[model samples]
Target: MTSLGVIFQPWSPPERLRETAVAAERAGLDELWVWEDCFKESGVTSLVVALTTTERLRVGVGILPMPLRNVAVLAMEAAMIQRLFAGRARFGVGHGVLDWMGQVGARVASPLTLMREYVPALRRLLSGEEVTAAGRYVNLDRVKLDWPPAVPVPVLAAAEGPKTTALVGEVADGLVLTGGWSADMVRDSVTRARAARSAAGVEGAFEVAVFLMTDFGEGAAERMEAEFDRWEFTGERRYAALGSVEEVTATVREVFDAGATSVLLQSRTDSDDIEGFVANAGRVRELLLR
Candidate 1:
């Protein structure tokens, strides 16, 4: 069976983080993801806290921007988190949106190139292998992790476009796809990714995760429509209209049929809209589980 995860957007204070983590576990979510945004708390800290508070939920930082920190340091952090959490941690790495990278004065010339070099380097470091590489963007000499992770850590690459998706298939263990993908797009991307992976003779199955909006209430359809309008108008548009329980179910089915192994529902709501978001998650969970 395909898995279902939740993206925890911490648009609130830190104190609420623990409560939200606990609530998600109670809601029967398989995994919980947090984002690292410039205006919000760091994803790593939130992930640590969430992992400590929850017993069985797998926690992931949806993405840690490549340019934000050194690759060696990232490997160390990943190792420590994996060890501390007793192997209930996953890492999602990506180039991040250009606007956010600009805030840190980091320029990503070619994301695919950076990922190709960085990911393998991080893996080597995590395995306690001496890494020495000279790439166009990143260069390192004799870097190794003294404390390697117990198991091979799953690294998920966030891909949106066709090129990136294909690259991810070639390199990454799985994919954390963007939110706006349609069923047709999802199908095509997955097929391409799988073919690339297969051609390369990669052993394990690839994961495809799609983000979707969820809302449940009397005026759920209106609420969803308004949300769609905002996303489209603001140029953050990557969403399928999942207005009702049936619609959400259909969307999930479409994605699954399109080759997604996991679907993560991202609850987009106001700061004070927790009740509705939770209700919507419950409804979607019912549909997905069914």
Candidate 2:
């Protein structure tokens, strides 16, 4: 069975997350995701709040920018969260928006190189192994998490191109695809990643978590179209699921059919009714289960 989730966009105030998480759990959604956006919310803090307030809702940080935090610090933070919540926490790391990274003086010339160094070190730390590495971007000296999670934590990484996608398959436990692109494109990415995994002789379940742009209710179409225009999206294939519960559900189903282990519903960032959107996603999940 696929895991269904909703993103509590960083655009929403931090104070609203507690109620939002409660709503997601109460409505029976499987996971709730948060992401770090530059000059915005802290993904780790948001994940903690959401996890603390709910008994069963799994919280994911779809990405923490690798440029902003040291590999050792991230390993410590992730280990603490995993030990506290056990299997309820999911983490993904990425290049972050380069412009945002530059604004904060954390930009790297080659993000691909950063991933090459960062992910392997992080996985070893999370697995309670001592690591020492000196690389272009990440440098550590026998660093290890003293309190790593007793159970293994799956570390996911975000990717857009073939090189990064293949790198993720070779080193990371899962792949996180950002919003946009059709279901067919999503399938291709997963296939490419898995092929890389096989070539690397990596074995285990490799997860694919996709973010699907979604909108529902009264101005769903207009909201979706407006967001698409802002992104300068040009495509005949629907980029977002829009309209009623049933309609939105069918559109999301296409992504599942294409091979996503997890699908995170990402509503428009400027949306006014986040809680309502979570509830609607719950209804969609019910239909999906049948």
Candidate 3:
């Protein structure tokens, strides 16, 4: 079955996370995800709070920016969390937003090279292997995690194009697609990722998790339209699902039918009903089952 989930946008203050977790857990939603927006809430810290407060909600820190982290240190942090809450967490890493990366002086000359070097070494470290490698971006000297998660934790990569999607197949266990794509776009991405996975001769399935722009209630349209204005989004409403719960439900299905192993509802950055939005995400999952 596809994993249905929601995003806790980092646009709000750090204090809002507890209520966010409470709402999703209480509503019986499947997963809760957060992004490590540069200069915003720390992704790992937010996951700790969310995972600790909820008994069963699986949380994903999708696409932690590689430029901002040391591969070994990132592995250690992920191991620590997964050990503390085994089977209840998901982690993803990728090239961060370039503008944000540059602001912090973490931007690299080549993002593809950085990800390629980081992923393999990270996998070894998390698997409790002694690894030593000196690459253009990542360098580790015979490092191994003293405390790795009991089982191998899956690593996901955020991808928008074919080359990066192939990178997901080559190393990562899953592929994450960001919001602002229509269902047709989702289908094409999944196809590209799978083809890459097959060509890589990799065993095991690769997950395609897409975040869909979704919102509901009275102000949904206005709030989302304003978001479009901020992003200078024009063309079509094909990518977003802004309306009542029933309307959003069908939109979720459109992406799912397009071949997402996971579909996460992303509330507009300025959305005021984040709690209510997540609470109703369960209805989308229900519709998918029927």
Best by lDDT: 2
Candidate 2's residue-wise lDDT over 1-290, tens digit each?
A: 79998999888888899999999999999999998998889999999999999999999997899999999999899989888887899999999999999998999999999999999999999999999998999888889777988789899999988999999999999999988868988988888999999999999988889999999887888778878887677784358888999999998899989888899999897886878899999999999989
Model 3 clashing-pair count = 0
Clash tally, candidates in order: 2, 0, 0
Which 10 successive residues of model 3 have the least lDDT summed? 230-239
Q: Candidate 2's C-alpha lDDT? A: 0.90
What's the lDDT for all of these models? Answer: 0.77, 0.90, 0.85
TM-score order of candidates, top first? 2, 3, 1
**CA shift of 26, model 2, Å:** 0.5
Model 1: CA > 4 A from native: 233-238
Query: In candidate 3, which residue ranges exceed 4 Å CA deviation?
Result: 218-223, 236-238
Error of 1 at 24 (Å): 0.6
> Which whole-number lDDT from 0 to 100 does residue 262 have in model 3?
85
lDDT of 1 by residue, 181-256 (tens): 7778788888888888888787786777777666544576566666667567333344554566677777778778
**Model 3 local distance difference test score:** 0.85
**Model 1 misses residue 194 by how many Å?**
1.5
